[model samples]
Target: MYRFTGSWLHKALVRLCASLLAILGLKLSAFYFLGLLIVLGLHREQLLG
Candidate 1:
C-alpha cells in the first residue's frame, strides 16, 4: 500500500542523508587537520628563524 511505500521511502531518505553528512564531516575534519599542520609548521619556522 501507499503507507508502506511511504515509510520505506522515508527510511531510505534518512539513511542517505546520514551517510552524506558523515562523508561531509570527514572531509571537513581532514581539511581542518591539514590546515592546523600548516599553521604549526609556519610557527615553527618563525621560531627557528
Candidate 2:
C-alpha cells in the first residue's frame, strides 16, 4: 500500500511537469509566430513602397 501511494505521487508529479511543459511550449510558439507576423508586416510595407 505504501509503495502504491508513493508511485502514485510520482506519477502525479510527472504529469504536472508534463502539462507545465506543454503550456510553456504553446506560449513560446505563440510568441514566435507573433514576432514572425510583425516581421512579415514590416517587410510587406518595404516591398510595397
Candidate 3:
C-alpha cells in the first residue's frame, strides 16, 4: 500500500513539473516571437526610409 502511494505521488510530481516546464517554454517562445517581429519591423522601416 505504501509503495503504491509513493508511486502515485511520484507520478503526480512528474506531471506537475512537466506542466510547469511547458508553461515556461511557451512563455519563452512567445517572447522570442515578439522580439523577432519587432526586429523585423525595424528592419523593414530602415529599408524603406
Candidate 4:
C-alpha cells in the first residue's frame, strides 16, 4: 500500500509539472506574438507617415 501511494504521488507531481510547463510555454508564445504584432504595426505607421 505504501508503494502504491508513493507511485501515485510521483505521478501526480509529474502531471503538475507538465501542466505548469505547458501553461508557461503558451503564455510566452502569446507574449512574443503580441510583441511582434505591435512592432509590425508601428513600422507600418512609420512607413505611411
Query: TM-score winner among the candidates?
Result: 4
lDDT of each: 1.00, 1.00, 1.00, 1.00
TM match of model 4 to true structure: 0.95
Give a tens-digit lDDT track for model 3, residues 1-49. Answer: 9999999999999999999999999999999999999999999999999
Ranking by TM-score: 4, 2, 3, 1
User: Whole-model lDDT, candidate 1?
Assistant: 1.00
Instruction: In model 3, state the lDDT of residue 22.
Output: 100
lDDT (C-alpha) at residue 19 in model 2: 100
Q: List, residue by residue over 1-49, the lDDT tens digit for candidate 1.
A: 9999999999999999999999999999999999999999999999999
Error of 3 at 49 (Å): 1.4
Q: TM-score of predicted model 2? A: 0.93
Residue-pair clashes per prediction, in order, are: 0, 0, 0, 0
Task: List where candidate 2 sits over 4 angstroms from the true fold.
Answer: none
Which digits, one per residue and each the tens of the lDDT, describe model 4 over residues 1-49?
9999999999999999999999999999999999999999999999999
In model 1, how large is the Cα lDDT of residue 45?
A: 100
Tens digit of per-residue lDDT, candidate 2, span 1-49: 9999999999999999999999999999999999999999999999999
Candidates in order, TM-scores: namely: 0.90, 0.93, 0.93, 0.95
